[model samples]
Target: MEYILLIILGFFAGTIGSLVGLGGGIIIVPALLFLSAGSSLFTGINPQVAVGTSLIVIIFTGLSSTLTYMKKKMTDYKSGLIFFIGSGPGSIIGAYVNKEFNLASFSLWFGIFMIFVSIVLFLKDKIKPLNQSSSGIARTYTDEKGQVHTYSFQPVIGILIAFAVGFFGGLFGIGGGSLMVPAMIIFFVFPPHVAVATSMLIIFLSSITSSVTHIIFGNINWLYALALIPGAWYGGKAGALLNMRLESKTVVNLLRLVLILVGARLIYQGLL
Candidate 1:
């Protein structure tokens, strides 16, 4: 029964996360916490352990979704690589810091992060145009639909934001997609499909260091992770397909709604 519930949760997490460009950690961590609160099997589960487990599960979730995106030629490889490079060291640093901190405070602070993410998602449309005026390296990419998107971004700025995403991702046990996807769209003027696809790729790379550090710190739950994997894998494929069908504006609106709901839940949990 517990395994069944975890799998269901994982499915939802993967579907929602992939749709929004997150690595599913945001959904997984919170759901785990909620489940643990009432179940004997997960009773007294440490928040850090939940975060670590979520991160581990995200490895598979990210990979599954990224492959679909790759097939669609939706990813921006250069930008993804840039973000990955910056995120690597930042993830390691953030993981170490997370391990060193008190779990209670960290869980509460995660609520704050969620709230901030909600605000960012809400304001992204208004913000994207403001950031597009600055010119840097130009990029032209063709999607699976054969439509070409041409744009430019400030590489240094994007790298810096990626670093910050890595830090928060490690600290909060999220894939950083909640922050990174919107940041790319708003700050770098990346097309929505490109942002989501590229964010997933970068997340897969960045999570490597953070997951390793969490393993060293003994924070993972292998049984739960294993249970979650199949559901997440299947769900990711579903989400990737949906991503192609949805309009960019519709995706943004959906993302905003999810972020706000998740943020509120985290805030309420932290208050308790």
Candidate 2:
């Protein structure tokens, strides 16, 4: 029954994360923490361990979603690699810092961060594109429906932003897409599908770096991971396929609602 629950949790996390380009860690980490506090199966779980384990699952989720997106011609491979240059090292730093956080502090900050990401998502639609006045590398993409999108961003700024997002990802085990997808859409003017696809690739790379650091710290629960991985793996594929069918606006709205609810829950948990 415990394993069943873990599998279901992984599947749910993977589906939501991939559907919205979150990489699944956001859901996994928090759920683990909650289970630890509430149930015997996960009793005594710590934030570092949860974060580490969640990141491990993200590696699988990201790989599955990225592969799916790549096949659909939605992923921006070059851009993803470039962003990884910054996210990789940033993830390392965040994992190292994770060892110092107790559960309460971690929950509080993670909640705050989630709420902040939700706010950014709200602002994403309210803002206008900055690609016009921007001076940097410009790129173009055509979606499945033959609609064209043109966008640009300064590489230096993009790298800095990726670093920050990656730091948060490693710190919270969210894989960074909760922030990165919206940031890409708002700041880089990336089309929604391209941003989500690219985000998965970035998550795949960053999760590896973060999870490696967690491994060195001995923070992962490999046995628990055994249960979660299989479900998360298949769920990622399901999510990417679902993403192709959903409207971009619908996806963003769903993501925002989830973040707010999760964030509020975490904040309340921390206060106790």
Candidate 3:
């Protein structure tokens, strides 16, 4: 029955994750915490154990989404690689920091992080689009085929944001996609589809790193994590297909609302 519940939860988590470009940890971590509150999983270990286990599970979530994005060719390998270069190391550092922290502190910080993320999501809706007169370090690069590709901002900032996203991802057992998607769309002016795809790719690499760290630290629940994989796989594929049918603005607005709700819930849970 417990396994069955995990599967059902995984299905819901995966579907929402795929729809919004999160790594599923946003849903999975909270669900696990809620379920394990009075169970054996909560008795011996601190909240960090739950977070670490969620990060381990995110390996599958990341892979599932990455495959879906690859099938659609929505992933920009160049940008993904650049972002991964920074996030890879950052995730390791963050995981270590998480391991050193106590459970209460971790939960408090996690709640605070969610609140910050919610505010960012709310403010994102108010920002105006870039105008023609706006000036910045724009660059145009041509490939071997002589097609000119243009970018309106510096890549350096993107790398920095990726690092911060990765660190939080490792700490929270989430794929930085929740943060990366919005940042890419707003700062780098990436298309929503492109941002979603790129975020998945980054999540794949970062989750792999974080999972390895968790495993090495003996913080994973293998059986539980495995139970969630199949559901996430199917959910990711379905999400990729659905992405093509939805309007970008609609998706963004819906995701923002979801984030706000999730943030409020986390805060409420923390208070409780």
Scored by TM-score, the top model is 2
Error of 3 at 55 (Å): 2.1
Q: Residues 35-131, candidate 1, lDDT per residue (tens digit)? A: 8886787765577788788888888888999999989888888889988877877887787787664545655678778778778877766764434
- lDDT (tens digit, per residue) of candidate 3 on 23-98: 7778887777767765664344455667677776666666777788787667777888888887888787777777
Superposition error at 267 for model 2 (Å): 0.5
How many angstroms is residue 1 displaced in model 3 relative to the true structure, after the best TM-score fit? 0.5
Alpha-carbon TM-score of each model against the true structure: 0.93, 0.97, 0.86
Candidates sorted by TM-score, descending order?
2, 1, 3
Off by over 4 Å in 3: 38-45, 125-152
Q: Tell me which residue pairs clash in candidate 2.
A: none
lDDT tens digits, residue span 1-272, model 2: 78899999999999999999999988899899989888987765799999999999999999999999989899988788888888989888999888999989999999999999899888876887666655687889998788898988777888888999899989999899988898899988898888988999999999999999999999999988989999999999999999999888888888898899889988998888
Candidate 1, residue 121: Cα displacement in angstroms equals 2.4
Query: In candidate 2, which residue ranges exceed 4 Å CA deviation?
Result: 133-135
Error of 1 at 17 (Å): 0.8
What is the lDDT ranking, best to worst?
2, 1, 3
Task: Give RMSD to native, each candidate.
Answer: 1.9, 1.2, 4.3
TM-score of 3: 0.86
Query: Model 2 — which ten-residue stretch has the worst lDDT?
Result: 128-137
Screening candidate 1 with a backbone cut-off below 3 angstroms (N, C-alpha, C), the clashing residue pairs are: none
What TM-score, to 2 decimals, does candidate 2 have?
A: 0.97
